[model samples]
Target: MDLVQLDIKGISYSQTQTGAYALLLSEIGGSRQLPIVIGAFEAQSIAIALEKDIKPPRPLTHDLFKTFSDSFDITIQKVIIHKLVDGIFYASLICKKGKNEKTIDARTSDAIALALRFKAPIFTYKNILDKAGIQLKTSTSSSQTQSPKSKVETEIKSSFDLKSLSLKDLNKLLEDAVQNEEYEKATQIRDEISKRS
Candidate 1:
């Protein structure tokens, strides 16, 4: 099976699942997208990397893994979103250690968290995309719309819009949201902070 390359076009909070986030993968030169729900911490890690924020005092877990990989002279060649079983996505990391290449099975969230930190390409089997991806059906079917991509983009954009609130206000809102266990709101606030930086 051919591995169809995908890029992390965006990440957004999952409206249907509390404390979970939707990571959007856009097919290279194609109009299809795969949405995988991930945990909040993983989502924050990916968002921080994507936003290129370095203001944090302590490195996140993904950053620690990247540091470890660099220290060992290992390179992450790519990540493959290999399968979807019972509504869960599976992934693996392709790594190069010296002259040998190895694949390690990983949870999709951790794989993507590491992939974003390593700046590696992500791929998926064509059949997996066909099975898990919901194609956008447009009238006449001449040009299909990428509905998932647009939805994810819109959610992220809204979450990161600085004009939506003052920093002090957002911080206060974040504190209250976190206290209430409103992780979705907290993730949005975290995204807002990373976006601001």
Candidate 2:
């Protein structure tokens, strides 16, 4: 089967599942989006990778993996979302070490995070996209529209008492949340910092 390239659209908290996040991947040059549910930690890792400005004080697990791979001269060529079984997506990393190439099995979430760090392309089979892709409704007005997930994220952003915390406290909390693998919380803190600056 032919493969279709995908781009990371965004990540949002899953309304149907507590502590899970919806990772949206849009087909390149297409309106259809594939939503994969991932754990909170993975969601945070992916978000951090996407945000070029927000850097954790310490290296995240994904960051560490990238550094280790670079040290060993391993380059991630691409990531393929190969299988979907019982609502779970399976992915593999296409890595190259000089003339040698290897495929490594990885969870879809982890594969995507590493792919971003490696600047590798992401792809999925057309069959899989047809099975799981959602078409977004185009709006006719000039006013910007938001997804339900985006609305929820906005609500979360406004609910936090970020004004009460000092910049030093917020940074400390951000670091602690990342260290504790509380990505959602870390995101809110990061947003607060972004707003302040």
Candidate 3:
């Protein structure tokens, strides 16, 4: 089966799943998007990799892996979402060291995060894409109407009585959220700090 290249479209907080995030990957030349639900840590790691401006005070696990791989002269050539079973996606890292190439199994979310850090392309089989891809509606009329209400709800949830916390307390909460891999909470705390400044 032929492989189709995918690009990271965006990541959004999953409204249906508490503490889960949705990672959207779009076909390079197509409108279909595959949405995979990921954990908060993976979401944060991927987001940090994608956003050049945001840097963690300490290296994340994915960053450490990149550092270690670089030290050993290993390069990630690409990542492939190879399988989907029972609603879970499986991925592999195609790594090169000197003249040797090896494929290593990885979770789909971790593979995508590492792929971004490595500047490697992401691919998936055509069959999988056909099975899971969603065609985006061309019309934006309905979405525009619904967006404001959702945005308001999101703001209310993220605000979370941030006014009562000191700057120092907010910073502490941010650190704790990051350490605990509560990325959504960390984002809220970070936003609160940014607003204060």
Candidate 4:
């Protein structure tokens, strides 16, 4: 099947699932959108990469892996959202090491995060998009169906640091974070929980 390229257009909290985030993938040549629900940690990983914030004291696992690949002179060409099975999205990383091309199975979240960090294109099997993407009645209608200034976009820009908030406030903040696609705040909250335990 042919692959259709996609870009990460927006993310939001999943109304259908508690404590999960919905990632929206926008097709490059179409108005269809594919939404995948991912956990908070993965959401944060992708968000941090997207925001281009590299100030963490230690490298994140994905960062470490990317560093390792770079050190070995491996190049990530692109990432592919290859399949959707039983409502789950599947992805792969396309890498080039010397004269050989390698494909690695990857969680969709991880693949997307790496693709952003590597400045690589993301492709999805056309079938997957057809199966999972929400089709609109018209391209113009879909374009105006949601604006860039939607609630998620607004919240992403105004999110607060989770470490500075109390547990009670964190709960409320989580709601806002999900709405705004502030995965960094959500990740910080998860870390705070681990630290308190």
Candidate 5:
């Protein structure tokens, strides 16, 4: 199968899954986009890698991997999203050192985070994109949409104040947040509940 080159178009908070994010991979010179749902920490890692100015005080895991690879004179040549099983993506890192190459299996999210840090190009099989890519409507595609890294914040906001809720209500809300997998909200609720305790 021919490999279709991809670029990280954006990353947005998942509308369907709480505490999950949608990482948009756009086919070069094509309309279809591959949306991979990733976790919050992974999303943040990718976002930080994308924005050149925002450096974390500490090296993230991906950064450490990059540094480790650099110390060994290894370079990531590229990343391939090789398989999709049960809605999960599997990727492999194509690494090279002194003419020796290795293919390392990795989760799609982790692969992407490392790819960005390595400045490695990303690709997926044409068949994979054909099987899973979603086409967008005219008005809200690609450039028309806000950056997913930024969109991650706006979609998670709510109006309810945790301070006003009673212990019982707070616990109930915490339960709902966990059930919904809104972990960010759950953390906030958990903190408030902790304070009261």
Candidate 6:
């Protein structure tokens, strides 16, 4: 599968879920964004990495891993959000030591945190992005229908857990999204609805 580069846009505190934050990964040169819900601890670690001036009193777990890798001459080449299952994202860290390279399995959150610390780039399969990412604007796509957004683009929080909602509720959301001209959101709800039936 083709790989799409990603950059951390920001971390958002989930309005509907306690102690849960959304890690927003924006496609490097596109309007699509993938939001993955993460825990508070992982969120804190990623936030700290993004803010260069804010150093912790001591090295956090991710920081310790960075230190250990440096001592062993290991290089974190990049991070890849390799898979998504049941709304959970799976990732891998591409690491290199001397002439040897290895891909280590990791949680999507931790992989992103490490990527930031190492200044490594993040990537995901194009298909995964298509399945999970929300388009932030209308753009020419690869033979796919493009949703038009008005000039005043408001950020829309995606329906994170469609499986949790009853089919009736899912139908309601789909109707609302279509009425609101939220084609991207509607597309997601439609997919979930299709999965059930």
lDDT of 3: 0.80
Best by TM-score: 6
Q: Each prediction's Cα lDDT score? A: 0.73, 0.80, 0.80, 0.72, 0.78, 0.80
The lowest-lDDT stretch of 10 consecutive residues in candidate 2 is 147-156
Q: Which of candidates 1 and 6 reaches a greater TM-score?
A: 6
Q: Which ten residues in a row have the lowest lDDT in candidate 3?
A: 146-155
What would the per-residue lDDT of candidate 1 be over residues 1-197, giving only the tens digit for each residue? Answer: 98999888677767647788877777898866676768899988888888874545898888899999999999899999988766678899999999999999999989988988888999999988876543333357767654443433354346645456767766655554444444445555545554665
Which 10-residue window in model 1 sums to the lowest lDDT?
A: 148-157
**Least accurate stretch of 10 residues (summed lDDT) in model 4?**
135-144
Q: Which ten residues in a row have the lowest lDDT in candidate 6?
A: 150-159
Give TM per candidate.
Answer: 0.69, 0.70, 0.71, 0.68, 0.70, 0.75
Q: What local lDDT does model 4 show for residue 25?
A: 79
Over 1-197, each residue of candidate 2 has an lDDT whose tens digit, in order, gives 98999999788775545898868788999987677778999999999999999999999999999999999999999999999776678999999999999999999999999999999999999988876655454446888654354433344446657677778777666555444444456545655665675
Q: List the residue pairs that clash in candidate 3.
A: none
What is the C-alpha lDDT profile of model 6 across 1-197, one tens digit per residue? Answer: 89999998877676666888867788998977777778999999999999999999999999999999999999999999999876678999999999999999999999999999999999999998887766554435678754574222222344356777777776666665544544445556656865775
Error of 5 at 144 (Å): 18
Clashes counted in candidate 3 amount to: 0
Candidate 6 matches the true fold with a TM-score of 0.75
lDDT of 5 by residue, 9-78 (tens): 8776765467888677889989766767789999999999999999889999999999999999999999
In the range 45-72, model 4's lDDT, one tens digit per residue, is 8888887645578888788888998999
Cα displacement (angstroms), candidate 6, residue 140, comes to 15
Candidate 2 yields a Cα-based lDDT of 0.80
User: Whole-model lDDT for model 5 versus the true structure?
Assistant: 0.78
Better of 1 and 3 by lDDT: 3
Please give the RMSD of candidate 2 to the true structure: 13.6
